[model samples]
Target chain A: MNLAFTEIQETIRMVQMESLDIRTVTMGISLRDCIDSDFDSMNNKVYEKITSYAGQLRPVAEQVEKEYGIPIINKRISITPVAELLGHASKDQAVQLAKTLDKAARDLGVDFIGGYSALVHKGITKGDQTLLEALPEALSVTERVCASVSVATTRTGINMDAVKQMGEIIKEASELTKDANGIACAKLVVFCNPVEDNPFMAGAFHGTGEGEAVINVGVSGPGVVLNALKRHSDADLGEISEVIKRTVFKITRAGEMIGRVVAERLSLPFGIMDLSLAPTNAMNDSVAEILEEIGLERVGTHGTIAALALMNDAVKKGGAMASSYVGGLSGAFIPVSEDNGMIKGIEDGALSLSKLEAMTCVCSVGLDMIALTGDASASSLSGLIADEMAIGMINKKTTAVRVIPVPGKSEGEMVEFGGLLGRAPVMGVNPFSSEKLINRGGRIPAPLQALIN
Target chain B: MEQKRAVVSVVGKDQIGIIAKVTTCLSENKMNVLDISQTILQDFFTMMMIVDVSEAEDLAKLHDDLDKVSQELGLKIDIQLEDIFQTMHRI
Candidate 1:
């Protein structure tokens, strides 16, 4: 391969191993039309729409991945919540509708199906509660079903009732899927200030405001960024920043090209580009590998917070310069089970749930891949989620919790989601500090600290 | 009677651990690495090592084990059969 750079080669440089393109060109196919009391018609319409619109998506994405020689990891679909589609039906009916979606995704070879969800940030409506109540069974029965419950927002503060309810739902979810260590719970995400066009999951949803279909590309390049950082080992921090800025500019541009192409072909609007470092099961290219290169002996370590902070800031600085409409959670991620380096670290005694949470204080999300005991209390799980969610509220950044509570499992055991979900070694939780305070429920008021002076 | 030949290609950022880990895996697997050409481009360390596993019963096992080692050390390894490399890339 031509390694040297020339004036003409600058264009060619955008597509290389040191460059990571976005994982998916996810077309948010709105399921608003599928809303009906009759489950048959609604399910049929939803299934037909995604399979037809998304049939060509995989082939086109594969063509790009090969031609550009940059791996686009996942080809996924996000839609309106299944619960919303069954607004007119009973709660049990919505669960049936979600199974239909799971089947549709399986038929289409879409690996994971998101948007089996509810938004109870204000208060749980009958439909929202029904969806929430149906979540554990709905998520557990379906192979690829991913669920989300939104219980907080900056403008709306938080729904303490919803939070408390989710705590119970999570507990029940663990009981149902205990053998899988509540692996279904890993597919469930709780978000504060969640994004609509998120190309990542188990939290992505096709926001209500979107068109019938809009192609949103989530670009990733932690590997590419680490490769760039490798070039400047002897250089100072300022020089390092410049190196990352230049690298991120090219990576984001590659995503723009793919998104534009996919949108044009699908005859849909191009949505916002999520320039996040989404990692996969790939050996050397995962996000945890990037963190290890950041001088951490392992991913969940003492220096990880500082490393992720630099990565998060530099990625934005560079991506902002490259593209005008950079959206989504535009930061580095360290979801332990999703990444191989993290798995190895957990296996090697180099990572912990506490350290992962500490890193999330600076990075994206907190204790993301943690697997808890199935027997753990409802109030405790809520406390766990609330502790992480509070970080996002305080920092004014999007923080999410997608923990798997494994029934009959304890710390030091492993919950294997296999493949991309990987296997996460269960990390111990704090024994008893937050139980009383967490049970005492109300909206924790916004932090006065984040206010602009 | 033969040096069971295999090609190893490493593609990743230049880090201090690359050399130490690569050599260690090769030694532990009882393979003599022949003809090692290493270069650093920008920050990427690209190394091609021709390993001799003449004493081994299974070269595939060695390759797979070293693949894990390559990942732990944060490098990518491409293990090719000895005869395949000789026919292609006539440099």
Candidate 2:
């Protein structure tokens, strides 16, 4: 046989038993040209552009899945940040644009449509202000529209004003959807050093620099990595890193192949392959379990950071070797609600909010999908964002905050968001007030590393 | 002409008429089996077949046909493009 029997079985086992699959095949359609002076005209253009470019995204992805026999979990679309298209529009118009995007996603049968976003890391323009003001309404009314705001960058520093406003916006968004356990908050994220080519949602947006349209794919295989580690349980740390790298390399290669084929079928350009080990709420498909298999009793213990760092580093090393172009936030994702082990870690009292904050320093994204008490002050939320932004600014890595404060839910209670968003235990926040720091509304100066030129 | 190949795998308890049923369906669909290997691991029969699907009319229909055969034989059968295995296991 051209392929050994074991090789064939290995691929089958990865998909059938270990849950190896592509998380998303996101089509990035640039909408910079969809802007118009009239709000209705602009909305129509946006709708037409997205539907035309992505109308076949779902069917084509399904065809490829059948042919290749690799399950593709999501087919999504990300567009140019809506703030850029809102120059001639108002706050109401921003929400209207979100409605337009929602319709396009529904008509096309895509899972979610991202890029209802604003990039205000440096300062908020009139357009950015309108989008921020409309976020709560826009998110509350839409079923499939996801939004993100980038408030800090290493070169631009932290926008304290935007950070403060986002804290209020998060609270309002949660309150508006209070009946659904603050589900709206699950579709909104606040980012620092946000990537433009991310294929994963609530944060993916087609960058201004991208072409008219491109296809980016995100590969997820936490289960495959965990199973491989279990096979080499007796191996030392160096050997463990090697095992992770090899597994990542194989999965990344598969992702690249799928992405290129999908691009060819759509007659679009093949963009980067995001090699993120995004975990789901399924058993054996967890990043925390991989860390535990690496010798931690739980995910939030003292050695968790070191284990995560090694895994993140090895993923990049192997993924780089496998793909010619790999971008987005590529590392282990630690969303507390989405991964079974993380939920268990929180329930077992080993994972705390502060511990999660520290882990984000080494992982891919920041305090993702965490639930806070209803009484958590907006100032405390701003304080949490500020702290995570500082880590991203100083470390020059992409970080984000997507915390939900469930209305009428207190600490130690569970709020179910259901589906891929999963349920999270409401964790307590520090009682100490951050009002003093959050009240000072100005930008934090750029970090010393920003002068790399 | 270069042949487009796919892998057809079957796993179940060893039983009579399993191979005959699968090969009959492939010939009916104009798909030729290039090579095959079967083994009994942990008391379950496993078989891997590389088949030339280039001349086949419809891959989806063939998949459906094999699915029906699997149900009748009480086995799990899967057919996938060989490119997936080549891309993953081979550099």
Per DockQ, the best of the predicted structures is: 2
What lDDT tens digits, residue by residue, belong to model 2 across residues A136-178? 9999999999999999999999999999999999999999999
User: Which sections of candidate 2 miss by over 4 Å?
Assistant: none
For each candidate, report what fraction of the true interface contacts it reproduces. Answer: 0.00, 0.80
TM-score (all chains, Cα) for each model: 0.78, 0.99
Screening candidate 2 with a backbone cut-off below 3 angstroms (N, C-alpha, C), the clashing residue pairs are none
lDDT, candidate 1, A1-453, per-residue tens = 212223112322333444455676776888887676677887788889888878888877766554333567778889886666666677677778778889888887877778888877677777787788788898888888788888776656666767777888888887888776677787888887688778777888888877888788888877677777776777766677688777777777667766776678767788877788867666566777766676778876777777778777888887787667777677777787778788888888878777777777887555676676666788877887787777777676678888777777777887788777777777667777666776677776646644555
**Worst ten-residue run, lDDT, model 1 chain A?**
A1-10
Cα DockQ of the candidate 2 complex: 0.87
Clashing pairs in 1: A22-A219, A374-A406, A374-A407
Q: Candidate 1 regions off by >4 Å?
A: A1-21, A344-350, A446-453, B1-91
For the second chain, the TM-scores of the candidates in order are 0.83, 0.97
